[model samples]
Target: MIEFKLPETRYALNSDVSVAYQVTGDGPIDLIVVPGFISHIEFQHELPGYTAFLRRLASFARVVTFDKRGQGMSDRMSGAPTLEERMDDVRAVMDTIGSERAALIGFSEGGCMSILFAATYPDRVSHLILTGCFSRSADRLSEEAWEARLEQILRLWGTGELTKSIAPSEAVDPAVIAQYAKWERLASSPGALRTLLRLNRQIDVTAILPTLQVPTLVLHSKADLQVPVALGRKLAAAIAGVRYIEYPIGDHAVWTSNNETVPGDIEEFVTGRRDHGLLEFERVLTTVLFTDIIDSTRNATAMGDERWVRLLGEHDQIAREMVSKHRGNLVKSTGDGVLATFDGPGRAVRCALAFGSAAKQIGLSVRAGLHTGEIEMRGSDVGGVAVHAAARVMSHCGSDEVLVSRVVTDLVAGAGLKFAERGSHELKGLPGKWDLFAASG
Candidate 1:
């Protein structure tokens, strides 16, 4: 099941304008998703397919999504935002989140912005994924034809009339059309869309294509009606060492036609592995341990900085020793705590108990949570829903307490690891209620 929740939206200031943005997940890589034409941040999750698409992306990386100036929940502007201005908005969002580098995933018109951002700020971009994108708007339509199209859009705006143009495959479905209409209405007013579209047609990032210094992946549908597949091919050909893939489907919308196709392709390109085991990624049933010192801020205040630092150092060393003693891999330290992975749930349980004992000896109260589940191995890091579940399990813990999910209790049934039933709780951003137990032994 997908982790379902409306991510809390925050604002990133670009000059005086507030760019609405949201960040989700905690994977090693950071991804910034730039939306096409218009978007409503919260309204996006209302559609099941779109939510699933985002959840799939969030499964592998920390995703940062935002609304540009004069669009959805962001500050309204007087005129259409130029590529440079929109690029500033993306940078602002990244800066707000302290993201030094991120992979840019841009869809449709946003793809043009992504290209400009990647080309202009090569130092900040690690990888680029552009879907149904074009480098030169002039190649797609003549001036007269473009003007005529703009007029048509103005006339049919907000009435779900562009469903066929947007996603021809879903045009016949009334429910889909109705939902798209509502999304369009919430995305922007007719006047705003016209201005954005006019500006979008003026975008020509062809000159910067050769200057891109990062790996790029270009995806397009063969039967896309809005932008021809040839445009997508030309875009890929301009960039150095860019991988291009064209699907057989006809829809221009990224989340529709083949929902899994887009995310699956992206997953393979970015991580070198498809979701269904196409590449080198490994899946192992392992135990995850999350621990943190209780009331660390208060403790630090009472002990003072020098003494606190010394005690914290000792605490980390003890954690390392205990994890090693239990044959666990020290994934990383969380400043006030540590996250480790173990081969056996029983050993993991023993390690948590040892941590509590060790912390008490050092006059530190540490709480821990453990869960056994399959995890996606990403080089030295790990991800997937299990890690998120483990984190939520940790949040439910109290001072000097070691808690674990039911999976851990079941796995260590005969290992003599004692657990007191803690009942079930609904984990934040995760699906369903999970039964938890306190690791007493």
Candidate 2:
């Protein structure tokens, strides 16, 4: 289902240090991604929706993202990088890519750097965009309290504890937490992060905001935990001709969830136009389906990385077809499988069975689970109790079998679909015991 190809990574030399960067797409506009606190340019694609998000941006412009110096693929340093050094790295990357002028999409800590870059090189920046970014490090925190906050980062540096605050829903899944933990370890070590924190404490771009010469846009989620929306509002208020947009949902990693409109918003801002049809985001009752390839890790190991990746592509192709055949929205792919939503329970149940059969034909086994409940739609991503319930139901499934919650069976009562009682069981992470059933023809 992913259409964009991964860009080849290359290094830009800033004197002796090598800064790793990638370029994707061939549109007229060149867009640079200023990554946030934690980043592993290579491992980032492994995260859910990240690659797709980049591809979406690629559709409009040539996208460029690099590991900030001392983070990800960039050369590891003994000390934290200063704003001047980071800016030099950016210019070096721009020169290597032959990009004369480009829009900068700065996220989190990257926002501070972007602000500095835009102010320093007015001739080279086409537009300025900041999301989930803060202009000041203190963020209204008192000196004592701010120090405590910085210390807490040290305490949980490599534990993936940040996921709990930035992505609460995904944090519940052990696999997601483990992935984030590994990313933390790869991005920077505890000692290096400590050094960075000491330097970050002094960051304050408020004084330079009004002097920015390029067009700017500021976006924030009212509920962003990592960078409060208040800081975002303050940043926008200081800019002379800036546009600010706030969403009802909050997640620091807006590209991953909730703010599905983010890409479209960026598109409109940069291009002066946008796709009229954005995914409808609203709360509604629907049948949510979850499918997982059985023993995916083991299978990946046995098949080897390259072959396994090809197989996943095949699986995704079939899954997408089946969802469309059943008139369901394929919300997103879950690495080995997919999460989808359907208007009717019967079609979702049938699609699961059909997709399962198709998987076996390719020498793969898949288990599916379905539940009908109220789901909160955040653009293209779906979340809420119903979504989690469906994943839990799938976890209880056997190889190649299709399972459904009692709610699903009840909804499809007279649709001619038969379900065998699987009895009551506790769905992990959800309160209370619930009856589960196996769907059959």
Candidate 3:
């Protein structure tokens, strides 16, 4: 038997609320491991799987793990809590240990919270590692599906086999599953779990996604039942600078079920040797275009399935041709909209106006918005507040209209592209108001 000594735990953060945490190991780099849902620092080492995982992590850096507020050894406060509060809990833990910055390793739903923290406080994070996570809860499951899962949790409470069912891969070992159940029971109260689930459902970090600037690694199993692999890909696609890796089918608990592969990938990503996931293009000047089909749903209904399919085929071809002609990259189609990037804002603006004109001739009207900024070009897409701002600008335009921000206007001032001031408008998910204008013939 390998004897593991428990580290001295402590608490910090003088704000009306404080958080509990523990630190262990004597490595050079500090690594903070945030729990997925329920965790207890005292009980974790007793379990072989959890113990091995932490020990392996500690091999490379000093490891810190903590019980989140309202769970484990932390103070259980009354009333429901928000994700921001949970992030603040993480901040409190770091402050308690006098750690100015550390690599964050977050698991399951904890991955989402980690992403939020990295984006909101990039400077404080040396590196970010997310496992079995998603960008937003809305993208995780359908409303009916989410409701059904919540009902199951309510009915099962502590004795329910919900954990085993949700994580079938971990069910192979009875001892491990039993240990997990025991930890879950001891880590959090039923009411706290319910509230956490509710907060998970309401959490949305899609708007702030592009703001993430630190080195990021996203790892997910193809067989994750709680959160699908598609959600992981979506998150990687939305963030400007991130690396994504997919493991063969396994449970959401990467440490236990897929321990063989998880640690190796994490080690490589952190050391900067293998950037095998998505490529991160940072601070490159580029033109961004946001286009959406006007009244697309109504048109689909009017044209019926057959004709609508034909029209969409034509629409795609036309857009692709125009993009290729201008040396632009057709990122990906967003079902009802298309996102493309260009080398110059002038050409991007021209492409947008021409696309709108071309669509109008085919009885299909399109609206587009253009902006130029230092964008992070990730594999197959662009990201940053500039992209979000461009999307918001598109939301304000009518069919066959092309809108541009003042920054883009300045970039293409001498390009002979005419413009009409649409005045300033407050954009959703963006800070402050923006001065927008419409392109004219």
Best by lDDT: 2
RMSD of 3: 23.0
lDDT per residue for candidate 3 within 1-441, as digits (tens), equals: 112466776876637765667777766667888787777888766554465566556666688988777778788778655678888988888877778898898887787788888888888899999888887887877899888978887676665264565567546555445766777788877777887788778878888878888888988888888788999899888877789898887778666566546765776767653333223213455778999999999999998999998988888888998886664789988876689988667778878988888887888989998877667767556788778888999999987899999988887777798989998899998878899999975
lDDT (tens digit, per residue) of candidate 2 on 1-441: 012246888999999999999887778899999988768888887665577677677777899999988999999999989988888989999999999999999998889999999999999999999999999987757899878977887798778787887776567656667777888898999889988888888889999998999999999998788888899999999999999999888578876675348988999999988763333224566899999999999999998999999999999999998987775789999899899998678889999999999999999999999988878878669899999999999999999889999988887889899989998999888999989999988
lDDT of each: 0.85, 0.87, 0.78
| Angstrom error at residue 110, model 2 | 1.0
Ranking by lDDT: 2, 1, 3
Give the higher-lDDT candidate: 2 or 3.
2
| Pairs in steric clash, model 2 | none
* Residue 410 accuracy (lDDT) in model 2: 82
* Candidate 3 Cα outliers beyond 4 Å, as residue runs: 273-441
Cα lDDT tens digits for candidate 1, 1-441: 222355799999878999999887677789999988888887876543566567667778888888889888899988799988999999999999999999999888899999989988889999999999999888899999999988988887777777878677667656567777887888888888887888788789999999999999999999998889999999999999999999988578787658767888888888887764323235656799999899999999999999999999999999998887775789989999998998668878889999899899989998998888878888788887778888899999988888899888877887777888888999999889999999877
| Candidate 1, RMSD to the unseen true structure | 18.8
Residue 160 of model 3, lDDT score: 27
Between candidates 1 and 2, the lDDT winner: 2
Give the TM-score (vs. native) of candidate 3.
Answer: 0.59
Determine which window of 10 residues in candidate 2 has minimal summed lDDT: 275-284
Total backbone collisions for each predicted model: 0, 0, 0
> After best superposition, candidate 2 residue 332: deviation in angstroms?
14
